[model samples]
Target: MTIRMIGRHIREGLKNMWRNGWMSFASVSAVAITLLILGAAMVVALNAEQLSTYVTGELEINVYLNQQVTDAQGQQVAREIDQLSGVKSVQYISKEEGFKRLKKMVGTQYASFMESVNSGNTLPVQLVVKAANPRETTKVAAEILSVPSVHNIQDGENVLGKLFSFLNAVRDVGLAFVIALIITAMFLISNTIRLAIFSRRREIEIMKLVGATNWFIRWPFVWEGILIGVLGAAIPFAIIAYGYQFLYHYSGGAFVALSFPLMKAGLVAHKIGGILFGIGIIIGLWGGIMSVRRFLRI
Candidate 1:
């Protein structure tokens, strides 16, 4: 299309919006609401995964040695653990060290009780294995238990397994919700455009009578719809970004640490912004096309 024709179509679309003020507002509002919900869902999904990852990273496999094992025998077991696949690091917690840690964790509640129990009898020297992936922890735990002196393994496999499963389920549900919102938004916008074009039947009829090409007539309406969608999305995008910025700066620390699949605020915004913008444009164009198709049929 020529620049002049394109300009004319844009002016007409804007004029249509003003002439059909309530309908235009409704269309933009619907698009805005849909995009906003989808955006929020995506942000939540990202953070959920991050939080899960953080927890996984923090996971430790505790290999408790038989209290009968000598210190030299325990050290040999620790060396074997360090060489195992997926093991990030190995820290040896002597029975004495374990007792001290127990004291800190229990605080004052068990301080007096701890004094009566012999440290060697109460706690066994342990090889704490940190894994690169939480799933690998089970394998590491099994391997540690195979060692002669390592009589028991106490990795929190049951808990991590349940947590990972829950995270996956939540992510799937969030995705479904976002997809549904997108579809609903698309339909709502399409109907609004249909109404907008329906109100301008005479103008389209006149153009059709003049033998104007299909592209010539259709392009403008599509562009107009796309522009409206873009405009609508821009407002909420800014609002969401600003809100995230505020939360990240102030109320975000606790949330950040706990995120399942965590990300910094800046990185999350950068990744999601382009996607939201593209979604806005696509939905707008779709609405415009649907609206114009009916007009062309007549």
Candidate 2:
């Protein structure tokens, strides 16, 4: 714990790397590979979380009026739905707007179908209602459906629920994968460091014989493990960051224009990077402690 003792342990650790060169290299290499795998998974998990949050924030409920309702009646229905509780705002799309959208979707061939569909039968006007919470969507949807001349309601809740479920599955898988890798890394790294320590067994026994405390022997190896993990994560983190940036520019903007904030790829990547670094340090420390414990027991 004193400066002189700390300095001595650090010097000993550095020298041991050369003294037991192959064994030391094995330990460092194991730490590097383990951190790399963990960092990659961390990046993916973070991005998935960000994307899921974005999707939840932008969820909306769609209210469709009855075809039997006249244009004026549909307008009245929209006005009433807009005044309902938990409705952030109501956007009304008249039958004409619906036809225009249908025209855009179906092209000239469907123009005849549109005329037929909208002629005597009212094209149920669409009411897009925003809710403060996704759960509020169902209640708000029920109220909208209760309005006179509002025949049916099709809120995107089913689709959004499925999406969130998928996202949760992704998160769970990522977490499990990361945890498994970290455990493996800890095992391998500890074994590698143990090998290094075993190579210096006689020297450690001599140190113990000479009154060197256990802490004196432990700190240096822990520092070495920390160093190896931090170094290993650097390159993989950089590569993942670049890949995220490229995807953001190439696909994210186009994807997000259609969906809400679900596709902010850049922010997602940034968040992932931060998480990777934290995991790397913890795994590195774990490798160090496990490695030293085996030797300390001797």
Among all candidates shown, the one with the greatest TM-score: 1
Q: Which pairs clash in model 2?
A: 66-151
The sequence of per-residue lDDT tens digits that candidate 2 reaches over residues 1-298 is 5789777766866665666667556555555565556656665555556656676577677777777676788778777877888888888888788877877899887788777767654567787888767667788888777777776777877877787788678767866776776777667657656766777788789988999878777777776666556655665677667866676677755445444333355665566566666666677778879879866684
Best by lDDT: 1
**TM-score between model 1 and native:** 0.86
Each model's C-alpha lDDT? 0.77, 0.69
> Please, what is the TM-score per model?
0.86, 0.81
Clashes of each: 12, 1
Which stretches of model 2 miss by more than 4 angstroms? 1-8, 14-41, 108-122, 132-134, 252-270
| Candidate 2 displacement at residue 17 in angstroms | 4.5
Q: What's the lDDT of the predicted structure labeled candidate 1?
A: 0.77
In model 1, which range of ten residues has the least summed lDDT? 253-262
Give the total clashing residue pairs for model 1. 12
